[model samples]
Target: MADLFVAGGIVTALEDAAVAVGRLDAALAGNPLRRAWTFWSELDAARRHAGADGRKVDLFRLAAHLHGLPLRLGDTASAPERGREIAGLNYAIELRSWMAAPDREQQRLRDIALDSLRDCGGGQPALVATAQGMLEWLAGQGSRPAIRAAVPLYLRDRGITIHRLAAVTGGDSLRAGPVDPDGFTVRFLETVGREAAEGRDLLLTMEREWRQARLRVDHRAGARSNSRLPAAVDLLAASPLLSISALAEALGCSVEGASRMLEALVQLEVAAEVTGRTGRGARRLYGLKRLLPIRAETTAVQRRARGGPRGRPKRVLIAPFAELADDAGVADATPDAEPAEPTRLTAASFDFDALDRLIAAADERTRGVRRLLDRIARGDKPFPTADGTEEPGAA
Candidate 1:
């Protein structure tokens, strides 16, 4: 709450500065306007207090810089684009820095923020905040119900619906409460791991009916499946190229099954299908393709605006050791540089192409579970016994 208060204060301060600058610009343009320097004075005072790493302070500075740029340019034709460019640049860099921090879930959630920003076309601040909140929650979570509840609130605030959130997080409201928190986290981790492993989305679903004023579930899919797919998706995620047969072979399913899986992914509006399907049983390929590049660009730009590394090692430096010191006995010992850290892919570096593949896998999994549940509910398929034997279907 204190953090939120501080964040809000920063925004209000920036808005005030922008307003003052607008008046100043008008006066310079010979348009009559009221004078106001209070904002400027307050901003200066805030800057002095902000010290370093106060992102809000930086935002205000950028806002001031941009407010004056349009006035100086005169021909306002490109002002909107310039403003958007500035915002994107700052967001990308800051987000990247945040992802590189010590916490792993924070990094993962930041990736979710970047992808959400891509879809929303540059509005990711809320997503960032929500993700931060959720990650903080995850680190200290103790109860299954609490964890499940927290995820929905965070995702919903970030503009994701219950179903979409479920598709991404693989949490089923019906079973979320009774499950183990550690196991739940593992399931989520596994789902993402499988996604990383095979380049596919993790998905979960369940069926429910009301009985005597209470909602009762008729069928369910457990959390164990969530972690399995990420492993599967990771294997397929690397290929910039894909084919139906290749996917089918990877998924261990028939060509028709793979095709259906791909189709379901397309319906979720997550994965992109590459054009050119072959006739006479030809295989189709898919990629993690998103329609807009602005989000990706914005992420990159934010990193630059923040004046920090975007987490990916751009280059490696190497040097040779001149002398070996066994016990500090050798003089002028030059340190031999170790190999550069292997570049780990962050959410910022993910090709939307790979993300789409995960989304595809998630879709396929959702459909499979739905079909099985539907068949069971309708008496078309038999229920399995405790010993794993299926009973005969209803007549």
Candidate 2:
């Protein structure tokens, strides 16, 4: 009875999985950002698989590593170990060369698995046979993760891919969870369906953003009628990052021309140089400004100092100042008054004693107010009244 129920559930799950995958496939077909989407999908897969194996991979650094750029300084301590793991993940997720010619690598991994199995001695023929069948099934499938996980060649290998495959195939009976095959099938199918739906939504969003960006670029490129500019924008949109030489080669233009084009785009604020370098001679890398992380401080234009000259103005003395003062003195002086002791403003003449007392009183009042506020905040005292006494009828 239980077996019958399990089989029925799997049938339903298979239909859902198929539909989800089909939608994702349709979304990917002939998209202008297909390459970019493929790269993102592979990175996501690598991150998931690595997480399953208890390893954390930084997607940004992985992107940089794949782009052949040197890892930034602080990462050098764990460089070797992290580098090896990244290389493995890269090999696992890489599709271009694999899709071109997969037989060689597949054969190599198969031989490794077989050799390992043989050394263990043919004790459980059923288990060995099952493993062999999995390897063959893996070869027939186009999924890279499934193939990598089906083979037990790595010491830290966890068969996550095979479990996912089992979920998708529905016919392959693999224990996906501790409960039962039926529960595992249902759970995995649900998870895959959800992921596919989410991926499709993300793809749509990326496409929308890409299209808007392209239109903005086109509008900015207006009437000058430069065909290469739009093509270059498309290339940058599809690429993770590109150097001048690479862009030149792709556009079939001179390196200088590519440099000028990138500069123009940067100025237009549609593209940015990502290397965080300012020198003309630095090895600069460029990417779509909206899609990649750009150091704003490095790329922002330096603002010139505002207001007047940079330093104090030179002092100027008026030539007729003494004559003008004498004239004013004659006009204002009284005829009989014993030239009033030229009113002088000396430090000792002015009385600051009263002002000093006022300032001291003010300081004391400020300190008292601060203390009162602190006490109120701490709930040690009641709110004060208009006259600075505790409120009437208050606790």
- Highest TM-score among the candidates is held by which one? 2
lDDT of each: 0.32, 0.48
**Regions of candidate 2 where Cα sits further than 4 Å from its true position:** 1-6, 73-103, 107-176, 278-281, 294-395
Error of 1 at 310 (Å): 49
Candidate 1 regions with alpha-carbon error over 4 angstroms: 1-149, 152-342, 345-351, 382-395
Candidate achieving the largest lDDT: 2
How many pairs collide in each candidate, listed in order? 31, 0
RMSD of each: 27.7, 33.6
Query: Tens digits of per-residue lDDT for model 2 on 322-384?
Result: 122213665576765532212211223122332233234323433443344447558874556
